[model samples]
Target chain A: MKIISSPLELKEYLKGENNSIGFQGSKSIGFVPTMGALHQGHISLIKKAKEQNELVVVSIFLNPTQFLKGEDLDKYPKKDEADKKICKLSGVDVLFFPHVEDIYGTDEVTLSAPNVRGYVLEGNSRPSHFNGVLTVVMKLLNIVTPTRAYFGKKDAQQLNLISLMVKQLFMNTQIVPVDTVRESDGLALSSRNVYLSSKERVEALKVSSSLRAASSMVGKNILDSKEIVKEMRKSLGDLEIFYVEVLNLDFEQLLHVEIGNTIILVEVRVGTTRLLDNIWL
Target chain B: MKIISSPLELKEYLKGENNSIGFQGSKSIGFVPTMGALHQGHISLIKKAKEQNELVVVSIFLNPTQFLKGEDLDKYPKKDEADKKICKLSGVDVLFFPHVEDIYGTDEVTLSAPNVRGYVLEGNSRPSHFNGVLTVVMKLLNIVTPTRAYFGKKDAQQLNLISLMVKQLFMNTQIVPVDTVRESDGLALSSRNVYLSSKERVEALKVSSSLRAASSMVGKNILDSKEIVKEMRKSLGDLEIFYVEVLNLDFEQLLHVEIGNTIILVEVRVGTTRLLDNIWL
Candidate 1:
């Protein structure tokens, strides 16, 4: 795998790749952007990209703007050497490792999240978070111009909003949502999982367990969103709950769950670490 | 020239054009986005695009968001047939004529202008104006993906803000600024010019004449921005002057003029019609 640190160099390399293949036979590029601490979740996204496209480009940059003022930005995990090895093993053609300075500028043109949709649930807790996510994603999309981009469904709101942005802005990339990769015990894999202590790790299982409970209730013919949420809250008893939302695919709140189009999302604090998980029904 | 009302068709056409030429030899698409009351000013921008690019695309979208309540959105000029003919005569390769429904959607992603820079000049008077301009321009740029997009220096503040957006976003297209087109008597061309009565038209000359007076003062070694603006205001004289200010290219208020990087801008109302003009030094 070729590791490119410069955005311009990566852009030129992609341009050359496109030119060499010619128009009729141009190779499709699949991109997976991550804030670098690779786990099975990221690898799953990369492997899916590898399957779909002739060339796979993965970007690893710890974006500062996405983190709120007192958030885990400073202590966020960084495994650059390990990430490189994982990309190589996963058949990533290019590992784009850009610095924050390369990705952002002073008083830059920014993307704002939808007033109604963007300020709920995760956005409600961390208000300006999705704005940063949308802005950086836009910058990366422009730089990569990928044929398709893969995102984990664990970040359901992010995925939904990104898809909306692509449609609204007429961006050409296809946003593919990969299912959440979890532990054998059901804890969703997250970079922030590294921050959890052994006790906190045990507590984190409740998040996915609650999602599983919701899934089970749906399977047994309980479709009312309020009932499912009530059961989920019971399963997540005494945990620091941020929000337990049952939303449609468009992120709109649903009174009753619609199978195949509903997402049961949860955000809970495992000690001081925040972990998010979702189950799409 | 092919007239495409649907954005999807225009996108497909551009994609086919790219594919036919291949990447290395891909034709450069110069874009000119307008509100569609074509005159010599719009033609000048198109001609400049034609000179710089292999293909030129012109979009006629009277963006409703850019107009404030009680503004001329309902009565905004529309000459679709004449605009189409003008585009063909100007050798435009494609003319994108999209309806508001085709261009916007509910709860869509939006672009915001810089807090300090955006809320002055045009934005100050019509507070949310530049946000609308930036949002629509971003949409148009994404839809067109032009090699170079042309704008007239007649809307200097708009031009500056757009350029800032392109640079800050790291957008691929080049923003080419064309000089303002004017009549023999020195009234800068605008679509709003139609709103001016014959007498109002004569009164509007003060905008350009005031700019010329500022230029003469600068030529005579008067570099103080305040002094130049004072002279400009005197020339403009009580014709419902909106704003008379001298600022650097970045739109920051300049204490003194710096030749080659200054703009003296003016906005005045002739009867009920508001007109804007500027001089880039």
Candidate 2:
């Protein structure tokens, strides 16, 4: 496994890999980009990448630009030694560990998330958040030049926007959304979950629990969007619910629960830690 | 030579070409993107592309986004049949002619030019102009995926911004800056030159003439930037000079003309039609 810090070095290495002999299949690459503090969620994304491609490249870059002015940027977890161990064990072919200076310049051309779609949900709370997310993603995808990029549905809105970016920009890579990884008690695995206290961890479960109830309501022949959201609001039990939405795959509001197409998304604050979870039907 | 209006078809064709075995030397593509009304300047660009690469792809797209509201987008000249003939004559392998609808969507992730560089010079008069230019360029570059794309130094700021975009975005394609093509009378060739009436056409020569005088000053070892600019203003004879200054390749202002590194750029209006010209030393 190679650990490359420079973008140019990665490009050179990838170029050689593309041209060199002895690779299986059509010399395809699967990339999984993440912020550090790798948990079960990141591991699952890497696992899916390894299963599908001749080479798997994982990037662990805690981008500073994505966090808002008062967000938990400095407080974001950093478990580098543990992350390295995870990658080595998980059989990652390349690990892109770029410094902040290496990734950004004083003046640069950046990606802007679409006006309407980008400003709802996660974007509504944190404006210019998706713009930062997309700018970094665009850079990483170009640097890696992956044949397929893995994105967990845990960040469903991000995944959808990335998919839109890929389609709209006509990028070479394919975006494959892996399922959300979860804890035994149904809490979605997130690095931020570490910020949760014992009591807060238990409270975080309400997020997934609400999503699960929405899923169950759909299973019990509850097709109306309003009915499910109303029940989800009750299931959440008012633990500082930011939003509980029933959206189509396009992230548009839907009146009817279209099975195989609807996503039940929930975001809630337990104490001070914010948790997001969603269920794709 | 083939004329492809659909981006998907062009991609498929390019893919086949990449895999095919009959090309001489390493299969490289040189691309020249343009709006129609082909002129000597465009022909010069095509000629350079033909000299360097095995395959040359030319795109003639009259992009609406780049023009500000009521900024001659509707009045912009179009010479479809003549442009096609010129492409065929210039030995272009593929001519990508796409309509506006095929290139844009309702909701899209777009490119934003850097604040300082993009919003100065041309961007100052027309805000968000470079954003549209960059967005379309990003789309076209991704769709064509050329080995090396070509741009004339006639639009030095645009070329600089495009180069910046490709570098910052980590795009695979190289931006090759071709020299500005000029008329025998020293007027820089442009599609908008057709909008110049007989008297205005003669007045437009002042733009190039001012740059020429500045170049002569540098030849005579008169290297002070302000001195050169002062003399240039006198040469221009106050024909509505928008901007005339000395700068380095990075587009930052230079106090003294650094031989082999200086650029004298001028933007002037001739009877309501703006013309830009620059001489790189």
TM per prediction: 0.96, 0.98
Least lDDT summed over 10 consecutive residues: which range in candidate 2 chain A?
A18-27
What local lDDT does model 1 show for residue A207? 89
Which regions of candidate 1 deviate over 4 angstroms? Answer: A22-25, B22-25
Per-residue lDDT tens digits for candidate 2, residues A33-142, read 99989998999999999999989999999998889998899999999999999999999999999999889998889999999889889888889999999999999999
- lDDT, candidate 1, residue B58? 99
Weakest ten-residue segment in model 2 chain B by summed lDDT = B18-27
lDDT (CA) for every model shown?
0.91, 0.91
Predictions' DockQ, in order = 0.61, 0.60
Q: How close is chain A of candidate 2 to the true chain A, as a TM-score?
A: 0.97
Question: lDDT by residue for model 1 over B109-131, one digit each (tens)?
Answer: 89988888888888889988888
> What is candidate 2's lDDT per residue for B1-281, written digit by digit as tens?
99999988998998878767443313788999999899989999899999998899999999988999889999899889999999999899999999998899888899999989998899888888899999999999999888899999988889999999999889999999999888899998999998999999988888888888998988999999999999989988959988998999999999999878878899988889999999999
